[model samples]
Target: MLIFRRAKVEDFEKIKQIIKDCGLCDCDLERWLNNFMVAEEDGNVIGTGGIENYGEYGILCSVAVLPDFRNHGIGDGLVRSLINLADRMGIKTLFLFTDKAVNFFERVGFRKTNRSEIQENCPESKQLSSCPLSFIPMRLNINEFFENIKCK
Candidate 1:
């Protein structure tokens, strides 16, 4: 069976490997591992995702699934898990920088946003400052997401 849970320190190397395999950034991963979630199947780490908390704001980063696990809902599950974590942590808004998977994030309710918006809100975010200009910025309003879910 597959399990999703908080990433442990021992899982660090595997998580980083998966992230790198998926063509995502692995910079400063250790600093944020506490906030990461991993998908493990039969004792092997196949995917991971995490957030960079900034008080009421957060940046969802490093969401990745192994190539063999893509399209099996691992990525979606990881993203949903991170979103739930952010909600529970009182994050009001979430942002992300992605050069790929824009449609995937859109399916999860993240809308295209501008870099200036991210800089204005999360001035101290290292990811924001380092993300290339070609990357697309996306935002998700946590409160709105909850409200919409309630309505449905």
Candidate 2:
């Protein structure tokens, strides 16, 4: 069985390994320390993801999963937990910059959002620092986000 829970400081190493394994992004350890979720099955962290609050919004980041565990729904569970956390925190919008998971986010109900819209939010700036300017930015409206969560 898979379990979803708020990531703690102790989960750091496992989370990083998952990120590195997925080869999605070169993120700092300290950043993951502040925001993330973990998916465990039989005590092994098979998947991980995070939502960095951007003041009025949140940026979904650091999503990764063990290769062998893919297609088993762990990634979707992680994303749903992050969305629920954001909604509870009162964030009305969520954003992300991804290299290859755009279709995954779209399947979860996110749409391509212009960088111009993200630039207006300061919290999003920190998440964007060091990210390639060419990365596509996607966004989800909170109301729609909750709907997607329920549907899932």
Candidate 3:
């Protein structure tokens, strides 16, 4: 059976491997400590994603699914779970930098946004600075996101 849960202490290593195998982004232990999720199938981690908390906003990071698990909604599930966690934590906004997965994030209701929209002096802003010009910055307001999802 597949289970989706907030990543725990024991899940960190496998989660990092999943992130590496999928070639998403470097996994930061700090992000996992703050907000992270893992998709486990039969007690094995198969997918992972998380966001770096930045007060009112967060920088979404490291969303990846195993090769064999692609097209099975595992990635989407991770994103949804991250969004849910952010919402519950009183995080009002979530943004990510992605050279790829623009379409995927868009389908999840993340709209294209500019780095200037993010708060200055925050890690999210630093990430925006490091991203290549081709990488698109996307934002999602978790509360409205779920409302839209439920309406559909």
Candidate 4:
């Protein structure tokens, strides 16, 4: 059984291990722990994802799943959950900087966005501020997202 829940303080070490093992997140472990939602299976955390607010938009980051647990729908489910969070918060758009998983995110309704477009909406996203700047920015426009969902 898979469970999705807001991450608690106690989940920090487990979350950090996932990030370090995945070699994705560079932020301090505490920062990620404060910003993510966790996925659990039989009480053991198996996956995680979350959004960090950046003015009018948010940054979708720290999404990772254990290697043994990949290829299941957990990551997709976590993304969908954060997308719903962005919608509920009245955020018009959400973006992420990724070197891989573009296809996965695209399949879930995000599209590759130009740097200028991303900076215009979420200039504060770390990808715009300090990251190597090589990461591709991807965005989901909420109105179009809902329209597409309805059409499906």
Question: Against the true structure, whose TM-score is highest?
Answer: 1
Report how far residue 16 has shifted in candidate 3, in Å: 1.4
lDDT tens per residue, model 2, 17-41? 8888787664455764566788989
Q: How accurate locally, in lDDT, is each candidate?
A: 0.89, 0.80, 0.80, 0.79
Write down the lDDT that model 1 would get. Answer: 0.89
- Return model 4's CA RMSD, one decimal: 2.3
Model 4 Cα lDDT, one tens digit per residue, 32-147: 45557888999999988777776558788888999999999899888887777777777778888888888998888899987888777766555467545777888888778877
Q: Report the backbone clash tally of model 1.
A: 0
Worst 10 residues of 3 by lDDT: 119-128
RMSD of each: 1.7, 2.1, 2.1, 2.3
TM-scores for all predictions: 0.94, 0.88, 0.88, 0.87
Clashing pairs in 3: none
Q: Model 4 segments beyond 4 Å from truth?
A: 26-34, 150-152
Candidate 1 stretches with Cα past 4 Å from truth are 150-152
* Candidate 3 residue 21 C-alpha distance from true site, Å: 1.7
**What's the lDDT for residue 107 in model 3?**
94
